[model samples]
Target: MNVLWIFAHPEPRSLGGSLRDEGLSALRAQGADVRESDLYAMKWKAVVDADDFGRAASPDRLVVGATSKCAFETGELGEDIRAEHEKLAWADTVIIQFPLWWYGMPAILKGWFDRVFVKGFAYGVQRPDGRTARYGEGALAGKRAMVVLTAGAPEATIGPRGVNGDIGDLLFPLQHGTLWYAGMSVLPPLTICGADRVSPGQFEAAAAALRERLRTLAIQDPIPFRHQNGGDYDDDLVLRAELAPGRDGIGVHLDT
Candidate 1:
């Protein structure tokens, strides 16, 4: 299996960093080809600007979606963004690792998606029927993605009734809205809680868990998110009334 590990953490000696190292080693040991994008080590740019589109964008007004689409189609995206795209294309599996901040991914990682997953490449794709291909069908369809996150809070505190909210719900925007929308099958995330306090024994357990997850990466079942064109939703793009009736919110989107 070919894997692309995208890591976003500022400190190499941090818990998230150590887990990343462990995860990569596990993948390599399993004979998987792996590539990494250590955002902080690379001093990755965390903002999108006119330079991303080059001459594809208008000088006076910048519409991100339209301009990015133009740039992607014309092969005018920034070199760095294009390089990441190439990596995405080459890998069958993608692993995104980071420490949860303010209940979301780090700013740099978010920026990576904003720039690298441009309209034409990730979102603005269409099918023969002229319908937008997304939420299970797009340029990155057939690939697999998984998120590995570390949190300062304890596991219980992030559970169903925890103050911090369920980890799955907290990550819905990313796991569902972005990765799944781009047509990549998303595996259940591996969340290491209580990151701020870990005993040596606890660290070993976490490492073992990560290694186990990687071992089954190729055959593991992805989260069953509903497909847009799979008849789960109506013509207006809303979930059909019969499915998950009376239920709403993020959970309703899951195929279950």
Candidate 2:
């Protein structure tokens, strides 16, 4: 299987980096064709600006969405973004490995999404009926995505009643809103909690868990996030009253 491993850790010797190495080794041993984007090592550009599109000469104020859409369609996107697009296109599964920062992804990774996943390529797409094709259908449909995160907090703290909140809820924006919105089937994430204090034993356990997850990456069932237009949501894109009637949070979007 073709796999794209997008790693976003600055330190090659850190826990996150160690896991990335272990995961890659396991994937290769599994006979998977793996391509990796080591963001920090590449010194990846971490901002979206006029430089992303080739048509910066236009007199119109840079409408990023429209400009990016045009650039993507006409092959005018920057080489770096195009290269990433090509890599993504070649792979059926994308493994995003990063340390969760501020309850979200690192700036470089977020910028990677901002710059690479352009409007026409990843969003601002629609179906033939003129309805939006996102949250379940879009250009990236049929692909699978998985996140491998390392968070500083203890696992218990990220549970349902923990002060830091449930890990699933914290990741909904990326898993459901972005990945699923872009039409990828998001597999359940592999999270290494209390990373700073991980013992040798803990590291071994985490590595084993990651290897198992990687081995089953292709056939594993994706997180059952409800589709935006799958009759669970209304014309306005709000979840129908009939579904999750009593719940009123991001967790309600899950097909649990």
Candidate 3:
């Protein structure tokens, strides 16, 4: 399997960093072709602006979605963004590793998605019926994605009834709104909690868990999110009344 591992931690000696190293080693050992995008090591830019569109951008005003769509179609996106796109296209599996900050991914990682996953390439795709292709269909369809997250809070705090909220809900915006929307099947995330405190034994356990997860990357079942065009919703894009009736919020979107 061809894999792309996107690492977004600032410190190489950090827990997230060590886990990234372990994960990559595991992938390589499994005979998988892997590529790495160490964002901090690369000094990745974390903002989007007119420069991203080049000649495709409008001088009068800048509409991100529209301009990005035009730039993507015209092949005028920035070199950095285009390079990431190339990696995404070549890989069958993608692993995004980072420390959870303010209950979400790091700013640099978010910026990576903002720039690399442009309108035409990731979101603005359409089917023959003129409907938008997303939530299981798009340019990146058929690919698999997983998140390797680290949190300073204890595992219980990130659990179902924890104060920090369930990890599943905390990550819905990414695992569902972005990755799944872009057509990649998303595997259940590997979240290493209590990131601020870990002993040698704990590190070994975490490493083993990561290694095992990678070992089954190809056969692992992705989170069962409802597909947009999979007859689970109505014409207006609302979930049909019969399905998950009386239930709402992020969990309702899951195809349980």
Q: What is the TM-score of each candidate against the true structure?
A: 0.93, 0.92, 0.93
Error of 3 at 220 (Å): 0.7
Candidates 1 and 2 compared: the better one by lDDT is 1
Question: Candidate 3: how many backbone clashes?
Answer: 0
Q: Residue 246's C-alpha lDDT in candidate 3? A: 93
lDDT of 2 at 100: 87
TM-score of 1: 0.93
Candidate achieving the largest lDDT:
1
lDDT of 3 by residue, 99-169 (tens): 99999999999999887887767777667677888899887789999999999999999998999999999
Model 1 C-alpha lDDT per residue in residues 1-256, reported as the tens digit of each score: 9999999999999999999999999999999999999999988888888777553343333222322322245356677887898899889999999999999999999999888887767877657678888899887888999999999999999998999999989999999999999889999999999999999999999999999999999899999999999999999999999999899988899888
Q: Cα RMSD for candidate 2?
A: 3.6
Instruction: State model 3's lDDT.
Output: 0.87
Model 3 bad stretches (over 4 Å): 53-74
Rank list by lDDT: 1, 3, 2
Over 4 Å off in model 1, which ranges? 53-74
For model 2 the TM-score comes to: 0.92
* TM-score quality measure for candidate 3: 0.93
